[model samples]
Target: MAGWIWRTAIGLAAIIAAGVASAQTFPAKAVHIFVPYPPGGGVDVLTRTLADVVSKNWGQSIVVENRPGAGGVIASQAIATAAPDGYTLIMVASGHATNPFLYPKLPYDTFTDFSPISLLASSPNVLLVRSDSPFKTVADIITAAKTKPGGLSYGHAGNGTSTHLAGALLNSLARIDLNAIPYKGGAPAINDLLGGQIPMSFNNGPESVGQLQAGTVRALAVTTATRAPFLPNVPSMSETVPDYDTEVWWGLLGPGGMPADLVAKISGDFVAALNTDAVKERLGKLGAIPIGSAPAAFVAKIRADYDKWEPIIKAAGMKAE
Candidate 1:
């Protein structure tokens, strides 16, 4: 009996060592990073950049799958249900932090169901108007909205998107009512803005950086605590309304149960990738700042945002419409 027990112990030890060795050889196959927004959006762009560099460095291919709907619910749910293998991951936007409050019941728990890898970058939303519009600045929009409630409108990806929340926060802060118009995604909303269907919209910096430069759209203010590096001339919305700020930050995450060593590998590699000169230059052109923040910091930001917005969203009477 003693000899049999020793043999079983030795076999178990061998299996444990094998598991550790396999984990060390991470990304032995093609890895897929799920992007919750549609193609051409900021989150999509960030993920594609990281995947390009990381795959090249590891000598393996990385695929990015776009799943857009329900303010990212479809994609979030898919990632949540996927196997905890490190092969499947996601690059989430600010919507990930806000969805828990905006949606009454998400298909998955944002914190408990996922492991945060790192915050890749953050893109602030800028309030914009058509180039030839009479409104010279953000105050003009506020005054116009106040004078004619629901007369002024803004657009977003959907009901619970960061764009939608930015508009809501603006309304709450400025004490005005600028009705929100929902679109399937930012690309369409931006399309309508350029077509003059919507007067003004709070869109990400990269989405409008080109149009702004082309003189197609005129920017009034950005929704960051400070002016965006891309739009140095554009003032922050908070400059007019105290304590008012909004943005669409993005980060990488994975399905729960990733081993500590594997998680370290992913977080370290991506952070290093973000700092590469090529990656930095590309991000700068898009008007985005590459952060490559820590996993704990990312998790903490999500939790803090979840707590802060629950009451605010509830008061705004927002739903997934």
Candidate 2:
């Protein structure tokens, strides 16, 4: 019995020591970050920006792969099934929390199959129209919609995306009936908005910033309760529709069962990158505010957001189609 106990203790110590050593030298090879959206969206841009900085610091190449489809489900499932090693990760947006409610069955559990690393940043979705459009303010759109029920149409990235939910929330809160037009992604929706195919669109900051800055598109209101600093002149939707608030956020996650120590190390590194002046400025230009919450806090946020949006999603009858 004494000999057996001694052997078990030694084996456990070796295992722990190996984990520590591995974490200390993590990312000896390239790290791949799977992005659910196609390249050039807010999530993709943020992930690439952080990857560039983090890769430099870690002395390892960080590759961002775009796996856009089914409203982020493709990349999410891929990450959920990836090895628990820290090399593989996924950059998720606000859609991650609401996907469970949108789809009847997911290939992997949102909370169980992945470990939350950090809540990187957030930005408001803006209600934009072409500069030549007749609508000048949030009231114009609502009044027009109220006057003609489903006549006025707005496009979003996809059903159940933050942009979609923002439009739905506006419809519900303001008692309007603007028809929602779903597109494959934000880019196409913006294209239609610019081409006069759609009168308006709920676009993320990164998607609309260039147009807004170039005087091609007009931002009537942002979805958040407060005006986005990047678009200070634009009003918040809440100013017209009471209590209205919707913002998209991004975060990093790895497959579940990653060593706690490694999780901490990665979270710390990413958080550090987010706090740097250069990163903050770059994200600011894109209308994203750096968050960088602790891993536990990020986990709590995912749970809270999931709970908060489930009823909204169900009430809206949102689904992946």
Candidate 3:
């Protein structure tokens, strides 16, 4: 009996050692990143950019699988159920933070069940309207909404989206009853605004910068705390409503249980990719500022944002589409 017990213990120890070793020399093959939105979106843009760069660095192929539905529920769930190898990762946004509150139940937990790699970048949203509209500034829009509650209307990418949240925060801070109209994505929302179907909409700096310059739409304010570097003249929404801010940010994450060494290596290489001149210029044109945060810091931020956005989502009666 003693001899049998010793052999059994040795076998178990050896198996565990092999698993750890395998994880250490991880990504011996191709890796895939799930982009939860359609192509041409901000998250998709950055995820593809990282995919190309990371593939070269790893000397292994990297794939971006776009699974667009339910405001990221489908892709997020897929990532959660996948094997916890460093090769299986996802690029997520603030939707992951607010989903818990917006939806009654999420297929996965934003905090646990995943390993945070790093926060890649963020784009400040610009409040835009037709250049010929009467509302010339953020204050004008707020005053109109307050004076006539439930009268003014705004549009966004979708219900419970970051842009919708920005509009909600604005309504809450300004103590107005601005109505929100949801579309499948940003392009449609911006299109309707330009066609005079809606009074205004919140859009990314890159998406609206061209229209603003072309004299198609006027930028009222930015959601960031201060004016955007690209649009230096427009004041931040915070200037009018103190402490109010909202924007879209993207981060990289792998399923939980990735080996520490492998996680550190991938993270370091991804950060290095951020420094590349081509990537910097491309991201600049998209109006995103890169942030190469540590794994632990990214983990803490995911938790903090999940908590902070829950109440806002619940109060605004946001629901997943």
Candidate 4:
């Protein structure tokens, strides 16, 4: 019995020592961060910016690959099947949590197939109208929608996007009917809003900030529970509806079953990078608030969003387009 105990202790120590050594030498070569959307989008730009900083710090190449298709399902599937090593990573948007609800036949399980590493940043979707439009606040919109059900319409990027859900949440909470107009993307929706084709739009910060800055559009309220830091003057929807809160968020994830130590190391590196002045400044200019939350915190966020939006999406009958 004594001899057996000694042998088991020695084997356990060897396994732990090997894990530490592997984590220390992780990414011995180039690492890839798969972006689910096309190039030039917020997710792509944020991933590239962070990769640049982190790669320089580690003296390793971090390649960002865009695999856009099927409302991010294509890239998500890739990340789900990739090796569990730190070499394979993905920068996912808020849609990651909702995708499971939108696409019922996902190739991989949303919660189980991927490991949450960090919640990188969040940006509120702004509710906007032409600078000259009469609607000035959430109360105004709610009143109008209630006065004339199905009369007020708002444009969104697509059918099952954050922008779409923002508008949906407003409609539900305010108990008003606002005709939802789904556009191919936010750019076109913003154009329609400017052209008088649509009365208003729910647009992400990156796309709406420029218009707000240029004074071409007026922001009614942001889609967060609190006002966004980048748009401090704007109020949050919850301030009016009491519980209306939604925002565009991005995060990092690796394949499931990653060693806890390696997960810690990767999360530490990214969170450190997020804290740097240079990274903070750049992300600020893009209208994003860097979160750098812990893995457990990120996991909680994913679950929270998953639970929060499932019923909303189902009742609204939202699905991938």
List the candidate numbers ranked by TM-score, top first: 4, 2, 3, 1
Q: Write the per-residue lDDT of candidate 4 for residues 263-303, one digit (tens) a residue.
A: 89899999999999999998898899999999999999999
By summed lDDT, the worst window of 10 consecutive residues in model 1 runs over 15-24
Highest-scoring model, TM-score: 4
Candidate 4, residue 138: CA error in Å? 1.6
How would you encode candidate 1's per-residue C-alpha lDDT over 1-321 as one tens digit per residue? 999999999998996675577578887999999887778878888889888999998888999999877777888898888887689998888878878776778889888889898988988888888888889988889889989998889988678777788898988888888899988776788789889999888778788788888899888899888998888999999999999877778888888876656777889999999999999999999989899988888998888778867777887888886
Question: Which stretches of candidate 2 lie above 4 Å from their native place?
Answer: 1-15
- Candidate 3 all-Cα RMSD: 2.4
Structural similarity to truth (TM-score) of each candidate: 0.91, 0.93, 0.93, 0.95
Clashing residue pairs, backbone N/CA/C < 3 A, model 3 = none
Q: What tens digits encode model 3's per-residue C-alpha lDDT throughout 1-321? A: 999999999998996786677656766999989999988888988988878887897789998899988888888888888887677888998788777877788878877877888888887888998989999888898889888889999999899888898999888888888899998888899899989999999987667767877899888899999887778898899999999878788998877776666677778888899879889888988888888888998888777877777777788888777
| Worst 10-residue lDDT window, candidate 3 | 18-27
Model 1 C-alpha lDDT versus the unseen true structure: 0.85
Candidate 3 residue 214 Cα shift, in angstroms, is 2.7
Model 2 clash pairs?
none
